[model samples]
Target: MVASLSGWLQLRHTSRQLHSRLAPFSTSHASPSPSSSSLPQSTPSPSQSQEKERGAFSKLLLFLPGAITFGLGTWQLFRRQEKIEMLDYRRQRLEMEPVTCTRNNMASSESLEFRRIVCEGDFDEKKSVFVGPRSRSISGVTENGYYVITPLIPRETAPDGVQTPVLVNRGWVPRGWRDKVVSGEEDLDKPSTSSVASNTGDEKTASWWNVWSKKPTSPKAKEIVVPPPVKVVGVIRGSEKPSMFVPPNDPDSGQWFFVDVPMIARACGLPENSIYAEEIEDEHTAGAKNPYPIPKDVNTLIRYSVMPQDHLNYTATWYTLSAAVTFMAVKRIKTKKVRL
Candidate 1:
């Protein structure tokens, strides 16, 4: 009994010592200290803070394109206003009495665009060209035709201060002259000229217009030829730059599309950088009765009357797109608290 009691007491002492050694480890893992839990969190450094600022700045840069577009829209608005003023000026200029052109006044031809002017000049019939496939309005309907642009050598100096010849856009003519189907109708409209003195020696050398009006029964359409020095009243117009869609004038083939003054001058062996005028109505007609082009259609208001003015609409479109993009970008930045 004494040995059993001693052995039991020794085992109990060993168990107590083992429990004492394990107590600290179990308590340490189960519950941390208040000091450790209450300590402040580490704050980001200045460099990290600066990086976040840079990220925001980069997000703002995303609006660069939209800002540029907005600027362009503003510019277009200014252009629109300028065009309106120009139209007003043209209206006033056209209403004024036709100015008698002098070399001094003609010297400033660029400023005289769309202004009515009276010029005395001789038509260089040899240099006359037909610019065609142009559309012409006849009796409220449009038809394909050609414009007769004849170079006029001014008895006076050209407005550009050069004796250089100017091109005169006389007017448009129907291709019916060349088409037999169209000319067939003109034949039916012919009046009996048998009793109208065909015996007159001057009848054989009749003007191209008088002969053309006589129909198929009359002589065939003659080559383009203009009469002598005459007084021309019309608008002084500057040549327009060639358009992307318009085919370039073929000088070699004698085909002209645009009134490219320099090209036409070179092709016609006239002075380069030529100044030109358009004829509104012919004062050289035999009487009040107009002949040559059966229907004389003079387009004095062709350019100024149809100027385009739509900048406001374009500005609104660009602004709307910019606003939408800006709103989306701002919302994204706010929601994500980050830069795109």
Candidate 2:
């Protein structure tokens, strides 16, 4: 296949060379005339002048290469413009939709578009697993740990009859922390921004239970689901924490980053494609884990999340280069015409 393509390319090159040797003449518009001829108030007949002009044009035929090059440049510029516009449109549209945590949405049926969804149910903290993340490690490298994701039972109280429990990616913590998560011993009230601190329970628990807590990964196995249900509002999303370049000193689990949605559901003892959700209220606010504070106008969230690029400036540059080459090629071909 490769050899065939190479041969075809070689043929094309030869054809282009032949065309270049003949193009200047076809594109020429000049005429040949004796500029210094002194006549007795008489000029060549119209047919004679036209014949000379055509002969002069025939002398130019070396410009097809530059024309083809300019055409390709023009095509690239057009493609670049379309891509930039599409990205711009997506950026603008993303603002109206909520920005939820990435781990909230796991594919359920291998067929679904990611979108906003509300789930009603309390978390089964006992069955959750936290994936180790290199993005937030202290050794300047990835460490052994997991991102804690608990299932949230979804319900609808707005007279809408919607109820289901979706998964919630609470946050990340080191490996040993799971066993250390004694209900009464951990303190959740800390103004820290490290990986461990990032996973501390938020406004979900009572004054006592809300404090630093490690909801088990299997609440059913622990027999701990006896309580009022917790309601959650968030968005559905994809999660990924790559371990592509972590030091090998850490446990192999640390190297096992990036949420394989299928693997995650299977580990939960659920079918491989269970659907998940991220919480978000109609009253907009900064997204959880958002580096910046929420803007007063929630309308700007999508714009903030899906930022635009300065590609139009580059597009203009490419178009300008193409136009310049084309113009120069045209001018050169004109210069090649013979004058009589």
Candidate 3:
């Protein structure tokens, strides 16, 4: 009985010792440590909050480009339709009959633009001007050339009996021909000729044969012969507005880059209101030497200057880019939301 009591006492003492050792541990866990209490909670910092806001704003900004591109695509579609309608209207106008141009009737030339007109006139070749260096495709071959613009004195007189002159874009000429015509070298090769009675001449001999058979004349006799007056059939064209990239015309040096009607008229000693016309060749006429000063076909002149296909391509490109960007923006927004 004594041994059993001693063993119980030992067990009781051990339990007390264990409780004393664990008491401090339990209290330590119950109260937070100073370091942990002083530290901040896991809430977002100011910079982090600002970053989240900026992310959302950036995502919204991404949509701006998409919306703008989509709108541009729609605008291009409208542009395409407008181009189609314009081309159709021009085509219809091209099919109309030729109209006789007179000073009284040509006062409103803008309305008559692209319309075929007949003008009886004599060419003032001395005042001819060259506009270049333009390019044209001939039989699938591109050729660099210049346009020959001449003043045409109309046969019909104004109400005050004044002979009004109009500007005529005769056609494209070879680049080399410009210097020849400008320097008067073309007239130097001509032979001096005397007028002969047609009845006295041999029937088989042409009048041109006699002129060419004679010896070349002196430099003083190399004057340009004025051509006889004749009826001119051509299309009326408006003056061109030069783009920023085009070089300005140097009228003093006689270098013309583009056809500015007022400037060209003043340079050629014609009235400011002179009408501009492009001479078209008859379908049955033989091709001229040097394959130029050839006039473009009427159908070609009336066709679209800028093709609608280009706008269609632009529309497709912009819309596709918009869809891609929008999809990316939406995906990014969803990902951000999920993360949040």
Q: Which stretches in model 3 have alpha-carbon errors above 4 Å?
A: 1-29, 32-43, 61-69, 156-163, 187-228, 283-291, 324-340
Error of 2 at 153 (Å): 5.0
Query: lDDT by residue for model 1 over 1-340, one digit each (tens)?
Result: 9999999999999999999999999999999799988977797889999999998798988787678778878987887788788777777877778766665556767777878877666676556677777786768999887777777666543342224466777776667642432334433111121323243334534556556564443343233333434566777777777669989889888778888877787877876756677777654543424343332334445434334456778888878878877787777678776543
Q: For residues 65-156, what per-residue lDDT tens digits would candidate 2 score against the true structure? A: 44565566566567666766755654554444533322333324232223444444545555565545423445588655555566654334
Regions of candidate 1 where Cα sits further than 4 Å from its true position: 1-16, 23-69, 95-97, 101-108, 137-140, 153-165, 176-229, 282-309, 324-340
> Would you give me the overall lDDT of model 3?
0.77
TM-scores vs. true structure, each candidate: 0.59, 0.38, 0.73
Q: How close is candidate 2 to the true structure, as a TM-score?
A: 0.38
Highest TM-score among the candidates is held by which one?
3
lDDT of 1 at 8: 100
C-alpha lDDT of all candidate models, in order: 0.67, 0.48, 0.77
Relative to the unseen true structure, what is the C-alpha lDDT of residue 253 in candidate 1, on a scale of 0 to 100?
81
Q: After superposition on all CA atoms, how large is the RMSD of candidate 2? A: 26.0
Residue 23 lDDT (model 3) = 99
Candidate 3 structure, TM-score to reference = 0.73
Task: Give a tens-digit lDDT track for model 3, residues 130-224.
Answer: 99898888799998889988887765533322145778887888777777877778731112334533444453344466466655534443234
